[model samples]
Target: MSALDSWHPDSKDLANLAKERLSQKEAQYILDHCKECRECADKLFETIRSQPIVGERRLVKKQNWMRAATLTFFLAAAILATHWFLEDNSRSGQFAIEPKSLPDLSETIYAEEPSTWFEDAFTHAMVSPDGSKMLHVDSLGVSLVDLSSGEDLRAELLLDFDQVMAATFDGNGRIARFANRRRDMGWFLESGENLRSTAIPLDAVPVWAPGNRDVVWIRPPGNRIVLGEPPDDRWHNIGDRVLGLAWDPTGAAAYGLAMSENGSASVLRVRPLGGEVEIIREGLDASALPNGLAVAPDGQSLFISLATEDEPDADARHETRVNRDLDIYELEIKSGALRLISNIEGDDFWPWVAGDYLYWTHNEYDASVMLIPLGNPGAKPLFDVVGERDGRFATQLPRWNPSGELLAYTVGSWRLADWGLNLDTEVVAIGSDGDRGPPAALVTGYHADYTPSWSPDGRWLAYRSRRSPRPVPYYAGPDVTDDIFLRRADDPDAEEIRLTDFGWEVGDPNWSTDGSRLLFDSWDRVPGVSKPWVATIDPEHGDLLDVVPLKLPDEISGSVSGVYSPVSDDVLFIERLNPETQRLWVMLAAGEVEKVIDFTSYTRGGAAWTPDGESIVYSALVGEKMQLFLVPRVGGEPQQLTAEPVNVLHAQISPDGLWIAATRLSQKKEIRRLPLR
Candidate 1:
């Protein structure tokens, strides 16, 4: 073999390169040759392509890439840039190009290890049965992407991508099934080299029987399970209150988890045609039950990532924050035997049973997708590196640049436990490109900074800060209130221009289309009351012109936060209908009203407008995690994005409309394995 052909970095080198443990001396030699020889670039690109890495692992930009050796981090940094070249992406997106350099990787480089398939926030990735393809679903829609080529083989777009939920690959891997929140099922199938789809219009999503169209579904409200074929009216009741569902590889029987009214949970194995339910395991702890399930290839075992049975202790007299501890469990189908597969402190969830291994999301200080052997699965080692959240610092409300290169978020210190009383909070930003890092400090000081919004020109950023000159009286006692302020994005020492006056307790700010104004709401602590306000600013000078309250139609009631569109004159805002429900409404510049559908979420930072102004990206609860979703500006179905166990507090589209810079609330989870022997 030729020396140039054989001397290439493998996956291990790439991982080590990402962690900056790879030898930089050798890495420099390989890349210097790659720059001059097209053949060498091709060989290195092939190795980079074949690496078994997925999920978002952003490279840390360092001076070493330009000064010293070409490290293996270039292998990962080259991943999307190569795809961008083949696809000819417009302008600049995240990882469009790497400066070619190496080691000294930081925690920010691989902080969020998520799907590498979709560039934006991808919620779910369902690999095919043959493991040759993945059903890529995100806020945009669903597409069948080739695993090797990174090409979209098939796509079935249905408006907002958030509406596309609960997607899975069928037994043959040619057909895919998906459902929307409180909507019907839509089928994406491959027929004679063509992609086609049909709306099932059923109330609940149906889990397909192994090799056929027959499906088993759990009805809502009472959580009743039913056996039926789509497009037909007749259905047989299988069971009720199913928590999770799965089918055997042989298609002989189906498995489900049932939780009773008494808070007891059980696992049931039901015969498909006859609807005979056999209780495989009963009286499992109902608390922290698993949200997903998978059956082994042999059809003799089932796996689940279950949370600890103990409930989180409630705080004495403040906002309640539940810290749920999760682990993995396995059950033998024949013997009705149950075994704990994982005993880690962090969360190990979303188990997918493959041939001889079980893969899951392992999260601790950082979240990663990992797998372990089914037999003799030794204890999976915990992530030794501590994250920013592992310390007193925890991030919330992340906003990113349109290029996906920079992320701006709030970092605050939590004493005892975060009850929103931390006064050490500040707005900080990080970069994905080799930009060293974001500006030293966007907004910092004794005053707490929150809700940062970027300007259209990327020159100025607006945020809400608790920097009132005098103490404002909160409900309980006197406390520093919030006001709108603007700071230059590129300058750390620039004087911030205060937008709102001293008295008003302002909300988060959103810049106008031309960067001439900001839209926000006042009155943060008052419940059931939201008043819209606008602050005018000069795009060229970054000076606050004036601040005024906006008048709304009389019919629009409830606590409404004004979220102006980035690309249009329309005004988009969210109104809290109740403690559980929120209504998204859009008002045209011509005084016409359009009401979007209502969604439920307790953890929210208000809705944000997309770059195109056609859809608004927002977050709502999917299971226990807060994920990003999209609703059309004109009013239609909302598409959901992001499916990790982590919560996305905020997300926004970039200037070029090329990326969705999501601000994920700082969280960590990892996948691990437990022995079944």
Candidate 2:
């Protein structure tokens, strides 16, 4: 008080006061005098501002109590903030403050419910022509995301409809068009504006004309292309066998691919509004059916996605078609010269051209958004939406903002028709004879349960259940920690017992011949990388017995898929010599390993032991489909079992060895979109 009352405090002293370094008495003395002295008050104010605290400066007068109170409040707040800053910086001496910048474009903007699974069809997303908003739709509903406000403005619209077939936005993004489950087409304008609804054609594909002048869609019954607004849209019957459609960027013309009357092949045709129809190209390959079409910005060329058509064989078990070999081609409008654009290994479709880049979606193990520079032959993927092989999960539909600064796509895995990584599997048992009563479920629940194994006595069923939510490297359906579970074989409703809890993934549990112990594969902290070890568990009490490592040659490091021999004390498993080669091996309980079968030419799944244990049944990719094959335990020419077009993921012999139980799968996927930085 003595120093503050007689002389003005220095700048350092004022800074310390704002930082709460001065005693309470000294702080109060300085505050009291600053209200009467404008020069000293301004100095204290500048000192507080320079101290890097968040607050505003206030003026005070000797008699103004409110102004004095405001000043006092700001000083206290600034001091508290300064204390926290200093404390944090003291712990980390290298702390630094960086100026804020624009949001990182590399980061992704995902949906509110960012799951790993999706519905059967493609979930579409589009950006407003003005780039101010984005529209996303799926089985769940529709969402209109406002880019500027970072808010989902049209969440209420999603609740009003059960399913939205498609959605498009006007040039300004203030108006939106939607086709819903009731075959009704509607427009939603800005808040306080009236919403318009009317009946439209069902299962129609909606497209917005350039500049949002009018809406065009492919109507059914005659497969005619319609133009104009709902209830008054006019049909343009250019051809009867229309396969695909595209519109010019200026909205002056439309293009379509139609099959010839003879049905031998397809031809490309173009028609200007109210103008005569003209054939652009003819005699296209019939086996390579056109699935998607898009016109370049200059309107001089068109891009098309062609999928190899499937032709069923007379046997009803085989279909001749290219597996994931869809290709993209470009056609010049004037010259009518068609050239291939993408000749990759996967199925490419849904083309969109913007600026100097051509974007499309490719589906293989999972779907990916890909792009290539215009006039450049090489193409690369930006990211994987869904997958298991390489840390990719399900994602679809990618659209670019008009400004081209942001991109949006959807993320979720699409389940296969019968079985896939997306479905929660159950265990069912049927009679060995072809004729029997209705099959019954042996193990069923909300959780994913599969890979069922019957104990030697057939009294207990050992299966894997994904109960814990842990993020796995691939297969992004649900966070799964696969654990072994046991249930009564005879009682479907009986309470199940948990057999193992090692905090690691465990699967393929097989019982010993006597039903006393269980053998399974687990990826624990082993010495070598990419190798899984075999572990034994007591079937009676679920206790870990021991971990047996496969001592293989130096070139052969990885081993997995272990199953106990029903006839001997040997463990049969798959050993990998490299990424592309794997062989079946039998490891004796007495510590010796022998190669049983070579799987170098084809990819293989889990192998099953027959009732007599003389042979093994496994699934392999022979040609275009995954089929079942049988081979003797000692190894020889493999015998093909099932030649169906479907993939046989796993096969097991019935208890009586009369019929084989197998898990069959067929897969399909659609694209989606989300915000990208």
Candidate 3:
């Protein structure tokens, strides 16, 4: 072969060179040779055309061969620039591009169609009080689905909020109360209506009364109960340190779970319209954490959802741990006597009473709607609602219409472990100085992209993405198996190239300093067993070069975390010795491993090495909250960086050392209503 002909660049390398990611000299040499070589020029043109193009471009006149070739090169460069612009603009605003709202599939699917219920991991559902319509909420916005029409009842009232926390329909189903983390708003369910919102104090839980016209919510700091109306209404305090609330059927009285200074809890009843508060039951030894409450139809008893203490080895890094023992109890209003009602194996809460039945949600690996006759507490659930796929399905917030003919609840494939991955998460870029301009989304669609690692040159990003068809099971924990994807840091619209797809759990991807190898941890052939490995790949053709398994200590078997050092040929990783303890280890590129930092407490992965590789930044659970800490690579006392209440899941130091890009867990769940048979 001729000397010039032999120097052919692969598709990936050629695209990088076209985008100017290569050194100036390297890029110029390729361009110089392509100008005179027809074969190389044709190859380059085909590569550029194969990539995802944003918009259609008219071809230049081919009458002049040289001019056409030059125009082609410039056109490719322009396409890359356009992709970056669109990506940057989509994520710059208060919210990501208004998610293309989900369409009502009920219209297309017949009622008798088996397995017709649409399933989503991030959506919530709740039936209206009257049961004629249903309210569906998700990360994109709030949707009111009509049962009879199988369409959105109020399309104009579909409030597209970024993160919706709680949503409820009033007794008349005319007004709805919805709260995200920042604020709570009242939505009139009529057509073409706007939202009426009010600022909620911190740590306060907002609840709607039976009338739906009045809202009873707790005020933060002191936990004072307040009742107010919509549109800048006044709030009146009724009780103090209330942990939970429930309104009576008559709407004249409301009951609450109150906590004492010494950690004891009690139930109190009060009138929202300025009346004396009565202690229904005091000195109850129940745990301070109460999830939900509901008053008996006859006003003789109260149903409360309480959680037992979590196991010592439970991983708190997740939004909600698996197998969190929760149950519902019945308390006699007059005698203060309590009895367990439902004790299924799962995280069960959100109890709702309708007629003679008590309904609640059971959340294990999947979520299901469970119900039992109040008169027969010892009997099993009359029926459990689930999706047809047999995958990880969840059904929560069960509500019955006034007639009780149709049951409505929200169903999805996501469980508690999938919370942070599915909703309100975006790979945001901030300056090293913490000047967060407009955060850009790393990827868009139904799938989630997380744990982003910048390439050594800062021109590309490698992250783990959950785009597979199979749903992650609940017992598997939050560490899900995903395919590794790579995309240009600047080109948002460019198609992401998939690297690894063995169907094994993979995460914490770290790029080598030379940008030719990727270091990550993956589960072995056995379930629940994980090991660290390094893979050399050709980014130019998106081909895997070789896989090198690191020699791990015998004690380290269940799960391990690894990252490539930003400046050296070494890899830093954390290996769990047991459920409660883990140790930091370092390994050379050749597979030799050495223990570095011994950690007795809970430490999560996603640790980042400092630019100089002398220190590491990671998150550790300190006194119930996950905080950022900086530890020396050689091992010493770690320095705490942030002490806020927010939980930092992943932190990455910028290439320029000006910003720390982190994925913060702010709000986790939202409520919605779906129809059940």
What does candidate 1's lDDT look like per residue over 1-677, in tens digits?
Answer: 66666665555554444344445675566555554455546655665556433343335455454422234335544433343444453332222122221111111111233321112221334455655555655434566666567677644433333455446665555554464423534654445665446444444655666665555666554365665544653443534457677788788887787765433567787775574568887766433232557787667678765444332222211221234334566677767666555544444556665433455544443221111111123433121011233342344455655344555655542211112333322333332221223223456543356647778677887888765343221111134456787888778688888777644466778777778989888764565487788888889987778877777776577445777776676888788776557888888888777888788765344577766777777778777666767777777777775565555545555454444445444443222332212
lDDT of candidate 1?
0.54
Models 1 onward score TM values of 0.41, 0.38, 0.39
Better of 1 and 3 by lDDT: 1
What TM-score would you give candidate 2 relative to the actual structure?
A: 0.38
How far residue 635's Cα lies from its native spot in candidate 1, in Å, is 28
Task: State each candidate's clash count.
Answer: 25, 19, 12
Evaluate residue 533 in candidate 1 and report its C-alpha lDDT on the 0 to 100 scale. Answer: 80
Which candidate has the top score in lDDT? 1
RMSD of 1: 18.3
For residues 1-677, write the lDDT of model 2, one tens digit per residue. Answer: 55546788778778767665555677777766664455676677677767743343323344554444543564643333334433454321121111110111111222232211223233334445445555655445566777567588765445465554456554233444554535544543333455556344556655555655666667554346676666677777755456566677777777776654333234344444555566787655422232456677667777765533322111111111113244556667777766555544444555544333344444443443222111123422121211222234432333221122222233223322111222232221222222222212334443344546666666666666655343221222234455677776567787777766654556556777877666776665333433434446665654557656545455345665777787777777777555345678776778677777776423335677776778887766666555667888888899887665445545555445544544343443323221211
lDDT of 3: 0.51
